[model samples]
Target chain A: MDFFQTIIALLESTIRLSVPLIFAALAGLYTERAGVFDIGLEGKMLGAAFAAGAVAAVTGSVFIGLLAAILISVLLSLVHGYASITQRGSQIVSGVAINFIVFGSTVILGEAWFRQGGRTPALSGDARFQTWDLPFADAVKDVPFIGPIYANLLSGHFLLTYLAFALVPISWWVLYRTRFGLRLRAVGENPGAVDTAGISVIWLRYRAVICCGILCGFAGAYLSLAMNAGFVKGMTAGKGYIALAALIFAKWRPVNIMLACLLFGFLDALAIRLQGNPLPLIGQVPVQLMQALPYILTVILLAGFIGKAIPPKAGGIPYVKER
Target chain B: MSNPYAKLPNWAEYGLIPLVNLVVAFLVAGLVVLLVGENPLNAAYHMVNGAFGRGEYIGFTLYYATTFIFTGLSVAVAFHAGLFNIGSEGQAYIGGIGVALACLWLDRTMPWFVVFPLAIIGSAAFGAMWAFLPGWLQAKRGSHIVITTIMFNFIASSLMVYLLTRVMKPLGSMATQTRTFEAGGQLPKLDWLLSIFGLNIGNAPFNVSFLLALLAAFGVWVLIWRTRFGYELRTMGHSPSAARYAGISETRITIIVMMISGGLAGMMALNPIMGEQFRMQLDFVQGAGFVGIAVALMGRSHPAGIIPAAILFGMLYQGGAEIAFEMPAISRDMIVIIQGLVILFAGALENMFRPAISRAFASFGQRSAAVQTKGA
Candidate 1:
């Protein structure tokens, strides 16, 4: 019984970890689909995390915090969009500049304001998001393998975990089912074509990138509020970048992106778990080997030895209107 | 749209253009000092004195310049082949691992000569392997190199944290760092050479790595300008279609160039490994690769031009660290601001210099850059 419960706990933990990754990856997909490479996802997320944490801590309102996070990151997206879209600058440089600006700004501000050494004051428990159990979760507490897994592993995950899953299908619908989706795809492939077709390329890319920023804001908030309950300096670390790799591995597809996030989350969880659990027969591997799993897997996947993946053609090529 | 090149004196085209890039870079750096509320003149004076005025400071500046040389060469190599391999941070991580693992495993058995070369080769190989992925992806799968390189850096950092904390743990302490390397693995200093030249070489960590860095830069310059391989790379970067029509294999060139780029950047570990650190360390790259991007940009991605750029950046960085001592309000991160502004300006240089050279300006706005403005 204990063994079964452990598996359930493992799966739920995995889902919780995968949520922000899924959101960030899907967010990246929207921008890349519109030919705007969104490397500033990290900056936008970090900016939002600070914005939300500061607002929530001051006002004691999670909803207002979420709204503030979204709005601030949207502003960041505009800077990213403005520099890349209007100025005809290199997207990579612009993206990197944005990341540097946010990373430094957050640290500098956090130090200057609260003087807490680049960490925001922790949110009170009442101000935090509560993890609600799903309906019928307790009724199947005794059902064999699948029952324990579903009830214990899947039942009590954060609200965002389930939302992240739902986003996959919804994103699929938006990308493939809507008129704007078609225009985004057209922009990514060849903005010249979209321009000739009478849709404004700059406007479409702007919206696509803005949506990415908003989603990334929630993703950052999830990191602080949902997972860890507070923010620390470089807390997001480079997870934003890893999410981007997953975005590429999925080839900009929504459903595939969800799967990729879960896989990465699985590796992450296994790394954490190996410290206590180890393996059944092989005994304990070194912690280095366990933590190295994600990097090793990423290298193998990216080596193109497994298979091929193609990026959108117009990706990173800033659309200059005068031309 | 008029041809400014048609009217400019020949010196204006070649000498003034490159000189202006340098002047503009320093101006931006000065602006950062002004923003940080330091006297730009005093800071600039301090920076000059701290880097080259005194022997001790010059030595310290050289230590900083050594690492930049390797990374700057790395960026320049990739720029030549038109690949943006930002994975230098990760490659440095992997190479640090390689250097650490090799030194620990083989310290007892091998002689100094054999062990040192093996350590360098191993480091280079691991860094090359790190670069090989984005290279292959760009070659075979059409993946964006910039994005992939960024991903690798994160993965490398995570894995390094785990490794240092776990498998590569130093023998005695609890810090998340590897054990020190054997004395045989240490980099030998040429302070003896400094003394031979009767230069005040006291207390400078100057080592043989400087020579190695210069050689690598020269090698890269040769590779890009003096070889058939380099000829193809330049052609491909300027116009991939033209290179393809001329029978060049874009995929092969890209993979090779990226591997070389990563390998050269990986060599940066030698300075750390053979010098004071004397073993692998976490945060080893310390944004050297990222700074190399600015260095490469400031150098206009030209290999020969990178040496002075590297030295200048080295001076700025070393000086920035000292600013905290002289002024409490400012921090070393002022270097980052300077870097960002320079990169922003350099990348968009066409705006400032291009319009300045227009024929329409030949009438009144400006004349011959060297003589006409002087007479006016």
Candidate 2:
């Protein structure tokens, strides 16, 4: 029973850890599906985190912070769109530039405003999204396996966790069931065909990128206002890249993206939990190796050890209309 | 219609456009400095002075530029072959391991000259081997080089931490680093060379690696522009289908280009490990590999252009440090913003001003043509 409890606690930690990754992976899904290869997910999330943390610290309102983050992320997305879509610049170059810009500007602005060590002041009460317990969480705390699963694993999470999971199904439905969904996928596979069919490929791509911006905003907000009380320098710590890896591992499917994120999050939680713990034959595994496991797995996956993962056919190519 | 700018001379296309973009970037950066409550002109003055005012400062700037030159050339070589080698940081990290291993084994018995050459070979071989897997994957499996290279960076960081702390940390030492290399393994500073010209640099870290960087730049110039392999690499980059039709092997070029690029990146280790730190440490690359992208872009992938671009960034880094020391209002992070602005203008938004400039030149050309007709 104690071992089972430990496993449940670990699973709960995995869910908590993967919420931001889920949001970011979904954001990548939208952009990549519409044929824009976005390595700038990291930059957008970092920028949004800084904006959210700064605004929330000032206004003492998490809602206002969320709005600010979304706006800033969308603005950045438009810049990316302008560069790659309108100007026909290299998508990778623009993405890399965005990362450099956001990474630098955030620290500069944060240090200036907070007078702290490139971090925002810690928030409390309404400024942060607090963990909330579900109804009857305490009442069923003493019951058997199912009860503890509900109370301990499923209950008492920040509102964003629920929303992140909820977005998985919503995103799946929007991708597969709707008119925009068909057009978006078609655009990614062959923009020429979509153009010939009379759809505005550029407009569709812009819409997809904007949606990506909003999702990335949620991911960033979850990092600063929910998972952490304040924004710390380099706090994302390559999570955006990890999210991208997860997207590729899932082969750009919504349901599989969530699963891939969970797997990565589980590895992250295991790494934290396994520190200083000796295994039967291996003695103590080093923390760095455990931390690096996800990236190693990503490389292996990309190398087609399991199966070949194909990206969108038109990804990283800017659509050019005939003269 | 023909591109008006395309009719311009090669020097004007390569040199003038990048120069204009750099000027615009600095102007934007000056505004950012103003937002941070510092006088932009004063900051600019300090930057220039800090980089080149004194002999020691100039030496320091050159020291920084040496690393950039190596990494910049690495990226430019890969660019010539149509590959984005983002794994230079990782390769450099592994290259440091090779240097450390060589120093550990040979520092006690071997002479400095022999050890230095061997360490160069060791570092280059290690870096090339590290890049081999990604190159192979891209060549054989159709995997994207960018994604694979980025993933390798994380793996390299983890491997370095593991090696430093768990494997290479000497007994009784708590820090996550190797013991210092013995004197025989260390590279000599360039102060002696400067003193030959009756100049003193006051103990700056500038070393023999700067000369190595210069030699490498010349070597790359010959390799990329003057050789048959250079023609093939450029042919592949311009149009792979044409190269394939002409019977050039894509896989061979991809692997070879990556190995050469990785070897160049690996050479960067000599600057930090041999010249300055004399030990293997974490985060030694310090984003020089990423900065190489901007350097290569601004330099137009030419050795002649890259040397100047590398020096420019070196000034920004060295001068930025000086400003952070002298002015409390503008922190070191502000320099990163300036670099980013430069990269944005010179790379992603490179053609933002081209259309307008070309139009103006086009009208001027037409007016000249009409005047010629009237004269006729």
Candidate 3:
């Protein structure tokens, strides 16, 4: 592909690559806005993927596995909430503990049950997220300037890919239009005020985290079940972290978060495509540099070029009743 | 609602909440071990034995601990300045690449003694540079170091992987590694002692890297306590606004500490690269920089406390591999389980021990009086 085509290809691929991240980033937003820092997004996502993949592989039921994965992940999220939010423990410390517990347990169980080294067996067609082709997608795929791009790019994708995009609008509405949304935001930015106003801090934060956990579960399931068809060791591989970057980059706005995830996803997709690809003068750029793109951009964004975005005032701080 | 009439336990004054947490963790860890069918005491015994039973094992454990010292010091130094450094992994990576490049460039012309120092300094400089960017961002724009540093680590690791795989591919073997360093680039050994025992220190990769690690720890301790800069760092860490009112520049301390922290992280390469490895292979730091967080936390950011913590962690790491090797199917993973448990328990100690200290400090009268007071 020429430079123009590659750029176009990059944009298209970014959207595709960013689907899972969009889910995760928005998931992070919900929790962070509710005054809880969900550092265990990585662990939650990983655990969910393993559950989903394992169930899918065994039962040949993709939806069931995904649901089970979401449920299990929700439980883990609640545990995290209990530790960090309810118990008023250290957020980072609690996150680190949860990650380890999930990581090691997953590997241990994987070995004992699957006889595989920290990976689940891949699913067959019946068990996997079956890709659906949009009608007329192929006919216009090769039409001309925009035809091939749209057809080749946007036509075929897993069902979750569409859901990830749809979630942007849904998240915006849920965060802004609803009573729960106001309470959630109020709890995060000023929990004391919310508490004085007669709202329960723990319950609101708990509800928000549970929502985040469910979203992260879907994102995790999409990762292995949709993309790779199985869960591998360290499968999340810090994607949850990147989702956090996207979350911060978006300034906790659902719409902005979608853009940030897409940007990162684009960088990631470009990097993957660049691997072993012949370049005129660059002698094929190392994909590692490509992989590093999102982080570099994150660093740039976080360093304050972006306009002021205040985090929820009460975020990550445990409320202790000083009677 | 009428509970205000009751006295606050004098012990409850401090963060007594987190103290009880530690005891619960120990119980959890012990129970988990029991479920796995190993006696917790025997497991603890094996842990102790694996780390220090043999001098050579101590050597192995210390070698691992040496790298952690740099990483832990990196974390502690930043924490002292009130910056969370999740980017030590990247800084260490940069330092690794810096050392490799230095060896590649200077080893041919410079003597072993000269080249070795240059490599160490070069690594530190690279590590410092790593912190500089994030520090600049933090100071200039008030960015969050926790998120930024974590992001930097990813970029650094990915870049390293790409560099090794494609750009810096060694001449002979087409592996994801660079060429081995020349002999002169290696750190000078305490070969005299090993020669006295007539043991093959040559066969074993143990060297004077551990001593350097200890010296760095001492230097960091002195730097943190005895210096004006350290005072500022500690002040800022406690409260940035208070430090600001005290005329201490918070930004200056953040930048300085981040740079210093990164440099310390940079020195971590001395343990592996200059010792037995003599080259940067994949996973050169071997996640030690990441584990250093746990080490730093468990040690409560004290240089002296970190020594034991780092060594303890190193023991589990070595023991894990050994068990996995010996048992075949039994699992070396127990070591990681224990390590994770240790971190969890240590964090809980803050909740566990502080209440006792608080109770010991407060009088019963004052505790009871404070309890009855209503509005601020």
Number of the top-ranking candidate, with TM-score as the measure: 2
Question: List-wise, what DockQ does each model earn?
Answer: 0.24, 0.64, 0.43
Q: After superposition, which runs of candidate 3 have C-alpha atoms over 4 Å from their true positions?
A: A1-13, A133-155, A278-284, A306-309, A321-323, B1-46, B105-112, B166-173, B188-204, B330-339, B352-376
Evaluated with DockQ, which candidate comes out highest? 2
The better candidate by lDDT, 2 or 3, is 2
TM-score of each: 0.85, 0.98, 0.87
| lDDT (tens digit, per residue) of candidate 2 on A9-83 | 899999999999999999999999999999999999999999999999999999999998899999989889888
lDDT for each residue of candidate 3 in B1-376, tens digit (9 for 90 to 100) = 1222234454453224323544455567557566545566666566577656665665667677778888988999988887878788889988987788888887777777777778788899999998898898889887777777888888788878878876787766777887878876677666565557663343445667677788889998999999988898999888888999999987788888999999999988877887877778888876777678778876678888788778767877765665555444336556545555555555522444444555554566667778779433
Candidate 2 C-alpha error for residue B145, in Å? 0.4
How many Å off is the CA of A62 in candidate 3? 2.1
Docking class of 1: acceptable
For candidate 2, list the clashing residue pairs, or say none: none
Better of 1 and 2 by lDDT: 2
Ranked candidates, highest DockQ first:
2, 3, 1
lDDT, model 3, position A296? 77
- Compared with the true structure, what per-residue lDDT tens digits does model 1 show for residues A1-323? 78766766766677887888898888889998999887878877888888777777777877787788889888878877776776556677766766766776666556545667777778976556778787888888677887777677778767667778888999999999999999999899999889998889989999998999889888888777678666677777766776887887776788889888888787777777777666989987766665555555655666655565577889888786543
